[model samples]
Target: MVSMFRAASVAFFCVLSFAAAIAQPVKPSATTQGFHSRARLIGGGQQGEHWLAGVEITLDQGFKTYWRTPGDSGLPPRFDWSGSENVASTEIRWPAPKRHEDAAGVAYVYGKQAVIPILVKPKDPAKPVRLALALEYGVCKDICIPANADLSLDLNGADSERNAIEAALVKVPLPQALAAPADLSILSVAPLAGDKPAFTVTIRAPVGTKPALFPEGPENWFFSASHPVDGDHFILTVEEKPKDASGPVSLRLTLVAGDKAIETEVSLDASDLPR
Candidate 1:
């Protein structure tokens, strides 16, 4: 009887321990000194046209964070939303990041506190939307530290916070043309010779300054790394990823001139830019 009672007690203790583990909440590490993160809904709880979700990160006194493209070193921030419902789609609108040089190499980042505005569209506007974000990011000072946070927010109704955030997002700066009155006129698009399909785009710009072109789609693709050929105008040698060739796609080009910014949009066939 004594042995049987002892075995029963051990089984009960095991079940209690498992229950405790399940009850433990997942939260951001408190040991880290310099980094902080928060998420909030912008504008009021009204499902108005669209809702903007804001994610802000503040680095510790001496620490820094990485950009989408961390350059040579540092890990990019990861966001997971497995628990999010009522969210039809999520779009992350990142302000242009800055380049930073360190002992290891140059890195791109948004310093101080960076606010990333996300546009969320709900499938059903009447029902309240609940959003749970699981985010992991890396911060570096003398050494690198990984931090995480589980952020939750609800869309109650239309409000002022949402309006303020939307306003600030609208004022974010974009790239501009280097020359005065520089205009980007799309001349034509045509296919290039190769088994791997590609498109060549001809654009007109003011003489002297070389304007850089970037495509808005395919978040995995980086336009800055692709070199633009200079002649009487600018020509972009672009290749479409296999699955992206179904129909027309909108392309946005940003021309950076010191502190000035200019942007233009064009629509092109997804198959390839026509010759």
Candidate 2:
């Protein structure tokens, strides 16, 4: 079993709450949006062993944004920090995402607004770190629109926004060891009959529980909708194993039932499935 924690890749986190985990940058940078965004930094501008940097994004009413795993269709958020100076690296800490269902389709997005906390590490502890962010994200309602923001911050000392940053950080999912809850278990995994080749995930959960299985891993992997088999069981149709696959592909599954959710990772191989 592997931890579901996904380190920040490149600049920002599109995953549930990676933005709060390791999103690189220093200080609090915010700018007025010309379109549907007004993003700025909160509780930053400090030099420490690790700075708790955060971004607060507000969208126009009725507009929604996407999560790291957008389920069937949606755009994930992206960040670029190439414009920064005296920066070592950053990671995005993600909070659990909400499941959204609308006429367009099912999408994973934040509620009305999101306060994403990022963990930043500076190259030189003595000099102030400068952070520049070029953020690209999508907001949708009846139609989808792509938006961008240019925000930068200079870190010298801590701002007085710690309450908000600390609050948002609490929503981030913590690393959990693999466990088989008494009421639910993943039964089996195998390839399905298809020309393109896809696999099926079978699981058994207590009756009447609304079960949802979400896939998290490689960007190329695509997971389909979950199909109910019975009150005690269901199945997930996932992307086909690449025929030219070299090594095993690592994947994670989030099982949400009622208010409780379990996050676990396993390789999509026969050996990894439960007997």
Candidate 3:
């Protein structure tokens, strides 16, 4: 079930408030429009030394956006924050993406809406920070389109949208062990002996729970989306590799099951073929 297609090329183009004391609507930054979607910047006030923020994207029904690593095809969303003031650095924490298949290929994406949580570090803690974002992403349904938006927001320690940002943050896959839990976890990942490079991943989860796995490797190495082979076993095929990619490979695997997800890094040596 390894589906492969020519990668689609994307060209660049192009939330929220607190109560009246609790009933007031959470107001996001000015909205920027794109194809069939809208984007804005959200603030979660200040959390410790870092400022909590988000880039929220809302799309029309049946539309979807790509993840940081857009599996087989589709362009991953790009973020630029160089337009900000008093912002030293920012880290975009990605939520666990679901598997999306279309005529084009298999991609990891978010459907209908995506709230991408960002952690901003200020250059000076005592001063206010202005966060800016220039985002370019791909939206797809029957056809794919490139979309862009520019959004900005000044953080003044407002907690209007803190809950929303925190909710999205909970979806971010945290680093975990291969066998993190007894009910849901990856059992093993071993190289498959074949002309083309491949690996088989075994996962464990409660019965009837469908687990999805996404594998990411070093630059120049393209690992296809994990294809479920049998009960709890999935196959990851390597579609392309650099000429010099013949050494032990390190892969970041994100496995999602039900409401639980984990990101684990595994090292695979070509010589460790399954018997």
The number of the candidate with the highest TM-score is 3
- Weakest lDDT window of 10 consecutive positions for candidate 2: 1-10
Q: Write the per-residue lDDT of candidate 2 for residues 154-213, one digit (tens) a residue.
A: 765766777777777776654433445456655555666654345666665666777766
| Per-prediction TM-score to the true structure, in the order listed | 0.55, 0.71, 0.87
Cand. 2 TM to true fold: 0.71
The residue-level lDDT of candidate 2 at 181 comes to: 49
Measured with C-alpha atoms, the lDDT of residue 269 in candidate 1 is 70
Q: Could you tell me the TM-score of candidate 1?
A: 0.55
lDDT of 1 by residue, 1-275 (tens): 32343355446545643564465466533122324533333434444566767666776566677655554455567777677778887777656555566665445566666666777788787777776777666667755555556676776664556655565466344544323344544455455575544556565555564544444445432222233465333344443234445577665654332333345565557654332
Off by over 4 Å in 2: 1-29, 45-48, 180-212, 225-234, 239-243, 256-262, 270-275
User: What lDDT would candidate 3 get against the real structure?
Assistant: 0.78
What is the clash count of model 2?
Answer: 20
lDDT of residue 175 for candidate 3:
89
**Superposed model 3: Cα runs more than 4 Å off:** 1-29, 270-275
